[model samples]
Target: MATPPALVFSDLDGTLLDHHSYGHAPAAPALAALRARGIPLILASSKTAAEIAVLHAELGLGTAPAIVENGAGLWQPGEGSSQDASDYRRIRAALQALPAALRRPFTGFGDLGEKGIAIATGLPPEAARAAARRQHSEPGLWTGDDAGLLAFAAALAPQGITARRGGRFLTLSLGGTKAQMMAQVARRYGAPLTVALGDAPNDAEMIEAADLGVIVRNDHGTPLPPLDGEASGRVLRTALPGPAGWNAAILDFLKQLDRRGGARTDG
Candidate 1:
């Protein structure tokens, strides 16, 4: 059998899941349909590993891999609750092995509990300021206290680090983009097709990289700026916004696929 795309990397907040501050529900039938299809719905978000775990458990996706801290860390599922001990040790060792000048700062709830970690950098003044603005406006929405948060973002900036916003918090990374992470996952799973959906600036990378990029609308039914107007053919900007918008976009892609004999792949 030809390998179907094993992964659908989704931005949690404002894309697959709504931002209700907390206690948000995935759009029922849409989420159910994806789950039913046996497609691995990967939660790619700016959320900390712990925060993502809450959603993962709620969604009943046990042991799925997550691209956390804006791609600074790839948290693979292990035999038990947390990352495999050997894998965890490998990541730690790899991180420590880097020169002090090259290493980026990071933290997580797993550092606190089974939740996970949130890492940050202390470079790039503009990015650090941008992230600080977002995190300050919404406290407790992320895993850090004020000091940790600033220090977290700051740690990444100097090493050419930056943060990408999604759902509720800004994700700090040494220099990773959502598109790069999505591609990595696709290569790992041998996914022939990747249908990605997201809203907000942080999602631009994946939106640009996917075989089909679906831009979800906001609550007022306004499509965001085209990811790249010069390359308008690459994106399907929707008239609908929010969860309802995503529902429409995905359904449309499936319909288009069916009409074309499903030859659409390899963006």
Candidate 2:
């Protein structure tokens, strides 16, 4: 049996890395297995490029591009391209321009500085600084009623902005989403069998778009909203949390794929 070329698109904070500990130690086996199979692991995260780049390097992913800032844009290391880098200033301006009622309850990282970000995210001062170096998106805390949140998002939509509720904050970015970026990357790789894992609603689009959608369990014990798509039976849910759940799903899927003879096998 043969298998199609495959790649994995994953969320960071709660999918590949732990939510509280911020480590992927539990998924080490899966990480090693993916490397062994020569699979391309693309990071799709709400974290800024500066933050994703640091983790990517530590993971030994050499110069591989990442989908950063909640898909506000992509980051290609060593390539002096991508217009997303300069979009932050404009985004901030847009936020301020929103009606005072729509904007007042939200406090973004840009407004907080590194120290604020550190306190908000529980990252150390140094790590928080990296998180604060946002290029394409604005992640912030929303301190308002649900109705106000909806109103804010609606207001931003007319201005080519989007608000996504992440695990810890509400992220504002350009209209792009993980699904859009995932499609672009899929094209770059000749449209191989795509597998995506995520644990939050902000990730619903990408998860539904993948050939194999895996909803990993989150630390809060709440699963994401239902992933609606035309591809039935292609979506799956993991029972374990963090990387352990991530590992379980990938291994299980690979076994099913091998049996189905969907693509070329690495071994």
Candidate 3:
């Protein structure tokens, strides 16, 4: 594949999409600019491939792979919805193998069923079904105390299952991060300049790894603490929240790149 000037990796729920409505209409302008400039926008999220594929097609990303299942897997364009679920199965098995005391506190998607997922995520029934079709990771609520959570993680460590706390859930996977996937995608595109935008702690690695990082304001979730990049002016925060903030931060950054004669206009 030919190299583009830059690759943009973004988190979906609380970054490029609204926290409550899950809409991206507010980001249309920046999305248009990216398309015009030939910059590929890679959706990086904790959402499943089944879930991400819908939005990926809606956005017309055309063949760009997405980081799905919280980076436990990649969703290549045209790939079937029935992806390999071995990893997800392994994660589930590991959870089951834990002592009952530890296992009982974590109610994963597999345990929740479609209806429970719908209630938990506030997604429609159909969407919840899609979200439940996990291919690589297990996200669940951790009801145990902090010490118990720590013990749970330690017990799972022997099985190569790591836990990550996202905005609302504790996710368990064999362990690939958004930043790791970002680097892989960048290499596939010939290592172009990278930009990452997100709104939560799980997004921190990806944001910090990028050449330019954006922390889209997300008043609905735990605020990400100030990162080191902010002091260097390499990372920026938005005044608006969700897609609106995403739009403004992206446009402003691209403009700054243009001013510096660094924005790529050629394909």
The prediction achieving the highest TM-score against the true structure is 3
Candidate 3's C-alpha runs over 4 A off are 264-267
Error of 1 at 248 (Å): 1.9
**Candidate order (lDDT):** 3, 2, 1
Rate residue 97 of model 1 by lDDT: 50
Highest lDDT against the true fold, candidate: 3
lDDT value, residue 258 of candidate 2: 68
Candidate 3 lDDT over 1-267, as tens digits, reads 777778999999888988878899999999988887788999999999889989999999988899998887777998666657888899998888889998888999999999998888889999999999987889888898879989999999988888877766788887688999999999999745899999988899999999999998878766789999999999889999899999998898789768876666645
TM-score of 2: 0.90
Worst 10 residues of 1 by lDDT: 131-140
Q: List per-prediction Cα lDDT, in the order shown.
A: 0.55, 0.82, 0.88
Clashing pairs in 2: 2-263, 3-263, 3-264, 4-262, 4-263, 4-264
TM-score, one value per model? 0.62, 0.90, 0.94
Per-residue lDDT of model 1, residues 1-267, tens digit only? 244534567776667665443233435655665555556677776654555655677877755677765655455655223432443343334435545544433332223222211223321444333223221012122444556546555654554546455544444445356778888878877877887777776777787788777777655212246677328565776665556666676666666655765433332
Instruction: Compose the digit string of candidate 2's lDDT tens values, residues 79-180.
Output: 643434467887899988988888999999989999998888889988998888777789999999889999999888887888887767789897479999
RMSD of 1: 9.9
